[model samples]
Target: MSPNRATTIAIGVGAVLLTSVAGYAVWFDYRRQTDKDFRRKIRKQNKKVSKVVEAENSAKGARTQQDLISAIIEISQEPTPTTPEESEKYFMENVAIGEKLSTLGPDAYVHAATSFYRALRIYPAPAELMQIYEKTVLPPVFAIVKELIGIANVIAQQSSRPAEAGIDGGEGEEDEEAMIAALQAAVAGAGRE
Candidate 1:
């Protein structure tokens, strides 16, 4: 082969090798960065989970009825102002209280119900307080917890049934009307009580 042709072929092969190495290096760095980011995110999430678990455990250990009642009171007294900020604050505060309430077990629910009924007696029968309790607070408190270790099918079957029979997912405007009527009836019943 001519020296010129040989030199040209050598140059071409070296360029190809250099390009391949550069491409692989770039890809490797990109993968490493993505993996690092993913690991950092996972660690952050794990810390949050640990915090929640710690809080739940501490709350369960305390088991103070006063704490439960106080949380409930905080939830109930959120301002009913017409402003968006007021409404958002109310929702956020209630969500925090709800999370705390979930940490408390079944006994806490009974106490909550008793406390609610007692408050109902004092609050001049069927007030906004009672309405909130019936609609927002009571349903979640009364939710039944099932421990499913090995019973996957059983859990699936149980979950399929709606807690309230009259309510179905596919109903449209008629469902809304029915819900309103039910609420009105509930308010009337509470007033009578």
Candidate 2:
């Protein structure tokens, strides 16, 4: 074969090899990213499932509000910590329980609020711990309190509204206002403490 032809063939082969390598590299990178994303998604889903299961398990034995309250009180009464780290750990656990209880239903709101309150009560008075509590813990606790108040208001309204004509208007409005005020006071107290 002519030298030019041989050179041309060699060039073509080299080009094909380079192109194939580049294509394979791109494919491999894409697959890697896809796999990473899939794994992340699966992990997120598993976390959600585990949380749901935990909530269910926690709720399984407590059939009544009194039982739930007793359980929460038991949790709150567990040994207090002397160190900030232990305090923070317990605070987080209580907050998590409160969050889970908040999801159960409006009936559980009191227990949820109590849990949050216990966390606040146990929180260390140090500057750093206070800051962390204010930043990470306060918002959710306040939110739960507000939610509880709202639910109470709704329940009061539903119950107080007359079902039939000429029925006496129940003590709905006053009770709702009182509950809201009490909740607000509790939240304020928690913030102060």
Q: TM-scores across all candidates?
A: 0.21, 0.29
lDDT of 2 at 100: 89
Model 2 residue pairs with clashes? none
lDDT of each: 0.49, 0.59
Candidate 1 matches the true fold with a TM-score of: 0.21
lDDT of 2: 0.59
lDDT of 2 by residue, 1-193 (tens): 9999999999999999999999999987787677987678767999999999988876752333233333443543477878988888988887899778877876676677767656766765534544554565445445554443343344344335534222243357675445434434443444465
Clashes of each: 0, 0
In candidate 2, how many Å is residue 103 off? 1.6
Candidate 1 colliding pairs = none
